[model samples]
Target: MKKLNMISMSLFLLAFLGCRSNDNIEYQANLDNAVRKIHSDLQKELNTDVPSLSVYIVSPKGTYFSTVNGANGDLMTRKTYFRFASNTKNFTSAAILKMMQDGWLNLDDKITAHIPGTSISYVPETSDWNFKYKDQITIRELLQHNAGIYDVTNDDSAYHINGQTYTDYMLENFPDHQFSATDYVKVLSQNNLTYGPPNTVYHYSNTGFSILSEIIARVYSQKSNASKTYGNYMYDHIVGPSSKTPLNIKFPELASDKQLPIPYIKGFIKYADHNEITNQKNASAHIGEGNGIGSMEMLSVYIRSLMKAENVLTASSIQQMRTSKGPATTSNYALGCTYVPGVGYGHNGATEGYLSTMLYDPETDFSVIVVLPFWDLRNMNNFEKCLTTLNVTAMEAKKALEY
Candidate 1:
């Protein structure tokens, strides 16, 4: 009687395992179909000359769905690399948090604090700085976009030396010029451009992040007693040895290093009459702010690992990075992340010819990454339409995972 009872229990357990395997297969199939539908709908809506699009979705069960669409879609795969602008801030923020975890720095440290063994402050202190409250800004404020530094790239005033916005002046006259963090700070200072005093309001400033990039280099240099570029530090520490899975993300070390790796989707700037190939534009000017290069799959993997605090950061530090420091212009932004109401923490990136979005939900361990390799320069409204489509794609991908 005992042997018969044991046999019955073993059979029941096998049945249960088989049912779960079937369920997983069904769910994965549903996710794939949903991704294909999203691509089809986008192609239909765009109607004309749709550029390449890539989407990657990952679930807690280790199920993944990926799709590529539009021109040269057949050539693009999950491993294809592209420039992910502004999403670089996520990496920058992670580097700072890693430093904090290692007891190298504090969030509330003032930008004016000198390095341990160096007379140089975290930020450059020179007569060129015209802002009165430069010394009062904190590292946390910069991460939260509350540093009140003027955005040289986004501000729309004739404040530059050429009676044009800094972006316009650079694009028109010096498109090839390699810009550094100090170069941007110098421009803002020489023009006496400031939004307001530090921590007073949330004004998104790329220049603020430029300053943070410099701080990362300075702190790393002082701690290691060796000179290293920010890009090298990132590869050696944050995404290299310290990550759960060493990510394939890269930062452009020089302006002349503009070529993407083989098997990359081509980016373009759409004009009224023609579409110009912009796949090789210099990215040095946007370092730490908008100049990260990786594939959608790698980005999803990185975000998933980051949100889980797996091998990268402590849970407490990740919590602090996710909590909103204060109000923001569009959404509740945390240290280096943007919180979408029902979506998770992530960021959006838009540069000359590419747009990308990445989000990861810790509760569900779900991640969505999307990248498009086209930007309409002439039709500004097209940009909004593209963003909406990307958001819809993410929402649909999330819904598909529920099955």
Candidate 2:
């Protein structure tokens, strides 16, 4: 999906996802019934109206829900393509954990120490990003997005919004758009990019993760005595164990031919006249620490591995990834996911058009994988809502699961 669909998606979601609807009396109904209704709506979208759409509602442990709707409607059961946008952080964080265990680096080590082309002047001005600044951010801070060097309101940056492409805009308008992380380290090795003190605030910066990716590439080359890049290293050590791969994040256009599912809301988008956001059209060369394209089954495969405690990491390390680093945008952000109180740690990704959410609760011995086309479809699978409604309707669904 592309950012071009945000305005429409947002409008649709806002209409149905009530500000107080979750707490409404009628919402507190039976889970199976809720699932059934969701299933029916999904059928309408997939089989009748929304043929280009796909939806998934996997049980916590990866069990298939009887309500998934796709191209084949009730008969379709394929691993449809999906967009992970920003959810890739979880995998990156896990790779960091593996690197840490190998003693190649320390959580407190300065980022410059591992990544070669880094410098001092890259630090920002008019601020105290020096003390807790340059050499202070740790591996943990980088993992949890609390490095204090983030700016979402920077007008100089660009990302897809509404129906406009922002990459070219950044390239043309903001000369500093090229002044990103790894590139910053290379050309401005004598400088650094610091906003505030390390560990002090949680400002989300895709820049931070990009730098981490660079560091991993450098460290793996040296430690393994093979000059192997981070991309290859992650596959061998990190994703290989869990059996997942980086998505095909090449070009993101308005229309796609990759056979990925595409569904639209009838009352919302003018599906026939809409321009497709083709991934082949918008070639995002390297801003991939966030959005990557793949199939829904892959997302489920990765999360299910985590649920089984599939030896992907040591028990202690798994706990570390799940542990909240500090004050994040929410409760506490672990390396990749966030710790939801009374719920498990998980992260939500809202890309231009795709929305993917996954969470695992040890307390309930379950997990949830909800993937939808638009971030705001009123006919959303409502997997998250099922969590809060556990005491009312979802409890019955849990009981009926025969688990």
Point to the candidate with the largest TM-score: 1
- lDDT tens digits, residue span 100-146, model 1: 88877878888888764567677667766545568888898899998
Tens-digit per-residue lDDT, 1-403, candidate 2: 5775997899888876664464232322333355556545644443333222233335533354433343433222325455556667776776776777777666667664543333322223323223235567666777777876543222123323343333334434642343333342332232333456776667776657766766676677766667665456656765554334433322132122233344222111213336234222121323335535555555655655654567355667788788747655444677776755544556655454455566556676655444444322333343333223222222333434433
Total colliding residue pairs, candidate 1: 1
Clashes of each: 1, 32
TM-score attained by model 1: 0.89
Q: Among these predicted structures, which one has the highest lDDT? A: 1
Quick one: RMSD of model 2? 14.5
- Model 1 is weakest, by summed lDDT over 10 consecutive residues, at 66-75
Which runs in model 1 stand beyond 4 Å of their true positions?
Answer: 1-29, 40-46, 71-74, 116-118, 129-132, 158-164, 241-244, 327-330
Task: For each candidate in the order shown, give its overall lDDT on alpha carbons.
Answer: 0.78, 0.49
lDDT of 2: 0.49
- State the weakest 10-residue window (summed lDDT) of model 2: 263-272
Mark the regions of model 2 whose C-alpha exceeds 4 Å error after superposition: 1-62, 66-78, 114-132, 151-195, 241-275, 281-288, 327-330, 341-343, 375-403
